[model samples]
Target: MEVLINLTLNGLATGMLIFLLAAGLTLIFGLMDVLNFAHGGLFAWGAYSGTWIYTSTGSFFAGIAGAILTGLILGLATEKWIIKPVYGNHIQQILITLGLMLVLSEMLKVVWGPNQISASPPSYLAGSWELGNIIIIKYRVFIIAVGLMVFALVQYVLKSTKIGLVVRAGVMDKEMVQSLGINIQKIFMMVFMVGAAMAALGGVLLAPYSGVIYAEMGLEFAILAFIVVVIGGMGSFPGSILAAVLVGLSGSFMAYYVPSLSLAVNMLLMSAVLIFRPQGLFGLKG
Candidate 1:
């Protein structure tokens, strides 16, 4: 029972972090069809920039704020300067974003030096609570709480707000929405910025969980997130969360029970999902 609880908590924490990232990717890559390989660059930037501010200001919350702000600003610049020009060209989008990914990563080394920096949770979230044979980490619970809040907030926005309705309508019938005099370009930009901010938040949160931050970490996790996106179904928000949780729990259990197969499990799962249901578990056939 203790082992079960521990693994559940661990998986939940990891899932939430991935959800933060995958949620944004769903908006940009899934809905807007941006294919933004540089989204992870925003994440890496958040870790480095947010951590720097946290260390400097002695406040973790402030670091989160800094990261979100940085992501929003960077997202705007990238959408306008980099992505806008290559909007309709998938090949160009892939090439440009991939190149930008490398640039953002290298720029991290330039600014912070080529070193892996360690991160620690704030004092309030530094320890664990013990219950009989089980121990629950405060930070992990906090992460789960944050993930739930984000999921709920996003759902609320998507369901209740005018902007959310328009975004959803845009995703389904972009031409029709545009015919109604809606500036889909601006909506696309907003989605990109929000997605970037979510990715940044994930990065900042992950630093403490990972205990170290590196530039290439973005690509590594981005791969996992891509897998999640594929498994969850393109443009399906709820599907992303469910798929992320499944991936997280599977990884946790596999790592403990079959360490050698831990890495292969993700690939195997993706392959199986591809083979069995190409549209993914929740994907729609548009």
Candidate 2:
């Protein structure tokens, strides 16, 4: 029972990280109708920049804030300069984003060196607490807390705010939203920035979880994020959360029990979802 509890918590934390990335990707795709392969690059840059800031300032919170700001700036720049031009053309968007992904990823190595850097959890979040037969890692709990907070915040923004209404409307019909006097282009930029910030947050949190930050790690996790997005249903924020939790829990338990099957489990899960529900568990049919 204790083991199960521990695994569940661990899984939830991992799920939250993946959720952050998928949330951004799905929203961008749904709202802007853009397939952003460069999303992963934003993540990698966040990790690199956040870690650097944390090390320089010796403040973990500052690191997170810095990463978010960096993500917003980069996202705005990319959306305006790179993504905006490729709108309405899937092939061009893909090519441009894929190329941007490479450039952003390479820039990380150039700025932070190609070698992997070890990142330790903050002292306050380090170590574990024991509860009877169960032991829980502090950092894992922190990650879970942060993830839930982010989820709640995003939910509130989507459900309660006027901007959220515009976003939802745009997602349903961009032309109508624009016809209603809303600046669809400006909304697009805002959504892109929000998504980028989420991805950056994920990257910053992930650095301590994996204990190291590297350039290629972005691509690896981006694959998982894409899977979670597909399984959860693109453009469905709640769907992304559900899918991420499923993937995280599966990976956590499978890694411990099945061992050899851990790597294949996510793919199998994705395939199963694709077979049974091509629109994803929560995705709306177009």
Candidate 3:
């Protein structure tokens, strides 16, 4: 029972991390209809920048803020300079973003050196709690809490706020939103920036969880983020979280019970979902 609980906690923690990354990707793809393969680059930058700031200043929150700021700047630059030209062209978006991904990775190596950087949780978050025979890691719990809060906050913004109404309406009929004297382009930029910030937040949090951050890590996790987006359905926020949790749990359990298939399990799950429900578990059919 303790083992099960531990695994569940681990899975939830992992899922939350992935959700942070996927949430933004889904929003960008859904609202902007752009395939942003370079989103992972933003994630990597967050981890690198945040870890640096954390280590230098001995303040974890400062690191997070720095990372978020980095993401917002990068997001704006990418959207305005690179993505704006390639809008409505998936092929160009794919090619250009992929190139950007490589550029971002190389820039990380140049700025941070070629070695992987180690990250540790702050003193307050470094310990574990004991409950009878069951032990729970504080850092893991912290991650879960943060993830849930972010989800709730974003959900409220999307569902209750006027901007959220505009975003949703734009997704359904961008032409109509534009026709109503609203600057849909500005909305797109805002969404993209928010998405990038979320990805950066995920990256910073993941640094301590994984114990190290590397330049190539972005590409690897980006693949998983894409997988989660696909499994949950493109442009579906609720679907992204649900799918992220499913993937996280499955990976955690599979790693313990079926080590050989741990990596392959995600692909299998995605395939099964695709075969049965092409639109994804929570995605609407186009």
Candidate 4:
């Protein structure tokens, strides 16, 4: 029972991390119709920058704020200089973003040097809680709480706010939204920025969880995020969280029970989902 509880908490923490990255990808693809292969680069940058800030200031919250700000700035630049020109062209988007991804990764090496940096949770969050037969890691609980809060806040904005309505309407029929003089371009930029910020947030949080930050880490996790996005549904916000949790739990259990198949399990899950439901578990059919 203790083992199960531990694994459950571990899986939940991992799922939250994947959700942060996948959430941004889904939103960008769903609303903007742009495939951003470079999204993971942003994640890596956040990890590196946030870790640096945390180490320098000895304040984890400040590091998170810095990472988010970095994401916002980078998102604006990418949209304006790199992504904007290739809108509506999947092949171009793929090629350009892939190139950008490489550039971002290389830039990380240049800035942080080609080495893994260690990260630790703040002093207040560095320990574990004991409860009779069960032990809960403080950092893991903190991560879960943050993830839930982010999900709730975003859901509220998407479901109940004027901007959310506009964003949703734009997703359904952007042409109509544009006809309504809504300046869909500006909306697109805002969505991209928010998505990037989410990805950065994920990266920063992951740094302390994994205890190391490396440039290639972005690409490594980006693959998982993509898998989660596919399993959850292309544009379904709720679906992303569900899929992330499923993936996280599967990985946690598999790693314990069948260590050799731990990595293959994700691919198997993705394949099964593709065969059974090409549109994804919650994706709308055209």
Q: What is every candidate's alpha-carbon RMSD to the true fold?
A: 1.0, 0.9, 0.8, 0.9
Clashes of each: 0, 0, 0, 0
lDDT of each: 0.89, 0.92, 0.93, 0.92
Total backbone collisions, model 4: 0
Tens-place lDDT digits, model 1, residues 196-244? 9989999999999889999999898788788888899878899889998
TM-score to true structure, per model: 0.98, 0.98, 0.98, 0.98
lDDT of 2 at 169: 89
Candidate 1: stretches off by over 4 Å: none
TM-score of 2: 0.98
Model 3, runs deviating above 4 Å: none
Q: Taking the tens digit of each residue's C-alpha lDDT, what string does model 2 give over 168-230?
A: 888888999999898999999999999999999999999988899999988988998999988
For model 2, state the Cα shift of residue 249 in Å: 0.6
Give the alpha carbon lDDT tens digit for every residue of 33-66 in model 4.
Answer: 8878999999999899998999999999999999
Tell me the lDDT of model 4 at 48.
90
**Model 3 per-residue lDDT tens digits across residues 50-161:** 9999999999999999999999999999999999998898899999999999999999999999998999999999989999989999999999999999999999999999
Q: Model 4 off-target regions past 4 Å? A: none
List pairs with backbone clashes in candidate 1.
none
Show the lowest summed lDDT stretch of 10 residues, model 2. 277-286
